[model samples]
Each structure stands twice: as C-alpha cells, then as structure tokens.
Target: MAELQMLLEEEIPAGRSALLDSFTNLERVAEYCESNYVQSPDKHRALEETKNYTTQSLASVAYLINTLANNVLQMLDIQASHTSLLLFL
Candidate 1:
C-alpha cells in the first residue's frame, strides 16, 4: 500500500509536469508563428507547420490530463478498498 501510494505521488507530479511542458511548447510555437509571420518567406508552409505542431501539443495535453485523472481515480479506489477492509476487520 505504501508503495502504491508512493507511485501515485510520483506519477501524478510527472503527469502534471508533462502537461505543463506541452503547454509551454504550444505557447512557444504560437509566439514563433506570430514573430515570424511578417518575415517568413513561405507564409503558407510556416502556417501549416505551426498548425501541425499546435495540434500535436493539444493532443499531448489531453492525453496527460486523462492519464492524471485515471491515476487519481485509481488512488481513490485503492483507498476506498483499504477503508472497507479495515471496517470489516
């Protein structure tokens, strides 16, 4: 039980860090697109690339959120089961 608790503690923070990193990347991409829009010789290509990167970043953030939610749910389930066992004992 302690080990499971430790794992959840570690995983939840890692998931959050990953989510933060994805958001940072998305912001950086947007900044880059805006900064280069006036200077980019190939505007269409740059826009396409930015769109693709933004899409991927959004997907990554979504997946991380789902993972973190699942982790929390699993932790809650474990605690509930432990409580039930204690009550029965």
Candidate 2:
C-alpha cells in the first residue's frame, strides 16, 4: 500500500539500517505468502496485501543492487587510477 511504502521510506535510513529493514520487509512478504497459499477470510484483501509486500521486497532488492553497483564502480575507479600511475613506471 502507499502508506506502507511511505512508512518504509520515511522510517528506514540508508546503510545498515536500511539493509535490516529490507530484510524485515522481505520476511513479512514471505510470511504473507505462506499464509495466503492455504486459505483466507478475504482472498482479494490477502492478494492486495501480498502485492504491496512484493513491491516492498522488490524495492529492497533494487536498493541492494544499486549499492553493489556503486561499490564496484568505486573499486574500478581506484584500480584505474593506480594503473595510470603504474604505467608511468
């Protein structure tokens, strides 16, 4: 839901806190999936809830991927800088 996303966006900070929050969000989705697969009082409501949870899960994954990409780029830049120095010798 929009509200859940808003809460997630506002409360969770970047870095370790964000990563832990993302894991918690993923756990919520997994728990929901486990419950919904059996039976539910309102199928539509459960489906909608699961959809929202899935969105949060995807956001977490995207954030992790972006973090990794940034680190990799930084490492490559450092390596390139060193290479240019080495070439001078």
Candidate RMSDs in Å, in order, are: 1.7, 10.4
lDDT of 2 by residue, 7-63 (tens): 345432344466777778788778877699558888888788788778877987887
Each model's lDDT: 0.82, 0.68
Kindly report which residue stretches of model 2 are placed more than 4 angstroms away from their true locations once superposed: 1-28
Q: Show pairs that collide, candidate 2.
A: none
Look at candidate 2 and tell me the lDDT of residue 69. 59
Worst-scoring 10-residue span by lDDT in model 2: 4-13
- Clashes per candidate, residues 3 or more apart or on different chains: 0, 0
Residue 2 displacement (Å), model 2: 41
Model 1 per-residue lDDT tens digits across residues 1-89: 98567647798788888888887887887888787776789999888877887788778888989998988788888888999999999
RMSD of 2: 10.4
